[model samples]
Target: MHTLKVDSVQLAFNDRKILQDVYLHCNQGEVIGLLGRNGSGKSSLLKIIFGTLTPSYKYVGIDDEFIHYGYLNNRIAYLSQDSYLPRGIKISDLAAMLIDQLYWDDFANLDIYKNHHHKKPEQLSGGELRQLEMLMILCSKADFILLDEPFTHVTPVETQYFKTIIKSISKTKGIIITDHQYYNVLDISDRVILLTDGCTKHLKNVDDLVTYNYLSGIK
Candidate 1:
């Protein structure tokens, strides 16, 4: 089983302290949610963990070994809010680049493909683009998947489909996702990380969310 441990990570950008003494732990077969307001270092922490940005003190361990970002693409897949599809690429091409069966007839049955009619990335709407982005990410076979706002701009139906896929992925892989859709994320997350002013705290249950005002009122 895969796992990640972040020990007292700190990062700064040109004198701005983006992340401070943050710690988090996620286990295999678990989906963890990272929540916070805009510019609160949520993405910075993810980047530090994934090795995108150099942390002031990066103490990231996978399973039990310490590693760096140079090898992350082979071990983890990070999906940003933007799709990295080549400017002239088609949906089928994007899937093929990631994995073959992902663009097969089985995946074709998905609403995303059916609605987009296998259109080129540049021609698709934002929601459709993100769906394609998600497909590529899921097909990559990475042990750890970090997704930022996976549901943003997607339709409700598409969001449901994506959530199902994420759950399935978590059955075999570790997932760390951040989104503005806190309630929906809480529904699927095995653990929740709430960030405020550069500090992070783990929320154990839905009750904590309600008690901490992270929710309107738990359902």
Candidate 2:
């Protein structure tokens, strides 16, 4: 089966080690929820796997073949917390470029885009823009996607909508997602893992999150 794997990931800034001996793997048709406390290197790890950040050391591979440039390989997509789309482009134009034409209607039907198809990213509210950005990434041709803080600015209703979209797309894509909203992550994940002390810990249950101090307690 196709898989994206990152092993022996080591990164540091000056004397501070951000990540070390970290490992993670995700296969096609699976959603892996990544949870961590603030400063636990979750975002940095995603950046390293996506090839946007040059770590001190890392081994990223797809199906046992080491990939030198993850982003340029056409097999990986990343949705950063910050806006990555061009502000001047119309929503329809951007959607056409990233998604298949057959899926255009499905994207257009989304509440976030239905009324703003002709508007530019700059004209949308923060929540609207964020939702649009996520939809574009999810609809991309890549087989593996990394999403950072996807639920940050959206309402609870919108967050649930995004989760449904994610589940639908994950039927053919491997997704690695991280957000401060841990419950949402847990809700959508096929499996969940925690990053702590520069290592990855496979979680067996929500209680494990509390054990690792990633959560105050199970809800």
Candidate 3:
């Protein structure tokens, strides 16, 4: 099975350390949920693994082979919190560029695509645009995907739908997803880890979230 591993990820801003000695790994057919509070360096760690943000130190590898330009590699894809699609581009055209032709029919059949296939980014609402962006990334050629705050600005139904898509695609791809929506992350992840106090902690159960201050209580 294909595996992506990131370890010894150390980052700092000026004199303040953000991520220190963080480690995470995910193999194909697995969705690893990442939980962290605001400013816990979750996004920074992802950027470091994706090679978009230079950390003080890090070791990133796939299948035991070290890679430098992670983002440039076709084997990995990173979907940032902000919208990645360019304005004025039709959804159909964007699909042509990112998604394989074999999956074109599947992509076209999605509810969002069926309604917005010919429309530009500006023509769709924020949630609609987010759904389209996610579908494109999930269906891309990348074998590994890093999703940052994918549930943001999306409705509960949309969030659940995205979870289903993530689970389905993960049969062939390794996914590492992080969001403030902890319950959703918990429900979908094959395994969950928390980034707390600049380290990674394996979560045993829902109560672990509370122990790590990720959640107040089960409620």
Candidate 4:
């Protein structure tokens, strides 16, 4: 079973603290949503999990095994708000770069990759590009996936599309996602972790989140 366990992780940047005593646990068939306001270290935490950002203090694990920052580039898949795809790169080639026919064939059956078969990453619209990036992540060999603001630039339809993909991924893989779109996040998330003032509090349900004023517009 794919699982991600982050224990007592702490991080700082340029003498400023970002994450303090952070801990997270996720497993297959579960969707964990990381929620917080802007500049609240939401993305930083995701980067720390994916090893893109080095932590001043930390311990992140996967399947009970310790994970190192240097080697996480290949072991985890990350989708950022920016498509960040290389300009002029072909979409088919990008997918191929992640995985080959054996994996692509299995991944393509998922609804997210249906329309992204051969489209160029640069030629795609914002939604298409985001979807492509997500599809690539799904097809990769990474045991854990970190998605940062996947619905930020996409349309409502695209948002729903990606949500379905996320739900599907959680059924077979461990996924940690952060999005400002709180409503949609709640709709798909099996568990919600609210980050406030650099601390995390797990909410049991949507009502719990609302009662705690974690849901937007409820305060």
Write model 2 residue lDDT over 16-90, tens digit each, in one string: 888997888999999999998889999999999889899888999999999877788468999998999897889
After superposition, the stretches of candidate 2 with alpha carbons farther than 4 Å from their true spots are none
Model 4 Cα lDDT, one tens digit per residue, 1-219:
867788676777777777886778988778888888787799888877777788777777777778876235566778877666687766666666786454677775755456665656666777666766776776576767788888877889878877887887677677888888888887888888988767788887667666656654453
TM-score against native, each model = 0.86, 0.94, 0.95, 0.86
Q: What is the lDDT, from 0 to 100, of the residue 94 in candidate 3?
A: 85
Off by over 4 Å in 3: none
Q: Which of the numbered candidates is closest to the native, going by highest TM-score?
A: 3
Q: Taking the tens digit of each residue's C-alpha lDDT, what string does model 3 give over 133-219? A: 988999998889999999988998888888999999999899999999888998899999999888999888878988888878788
Candidate 4: which stretches are off by over 4 Å? 70-73, 100-103, 106-119, 210-212, 216-219
Q: Per-residue CA lDDT of candidate 1, range 1-219, in tens? A: 878888887777789877786888888799999888788887777777778778769788888789788235567778877667777766766665565453366566766777765678789878778777787676565778888888888878778878988898788778899999887788789989888767787887767766656666755
> Which ten residues in a row are the worst by lDDT in model 4?
210-219
Model 3: colliding residue pairs? none
RMSD of candidate 1 to true structure, Å: 2.6
Order by TM-score, highest first: 3, 2, 1, 4
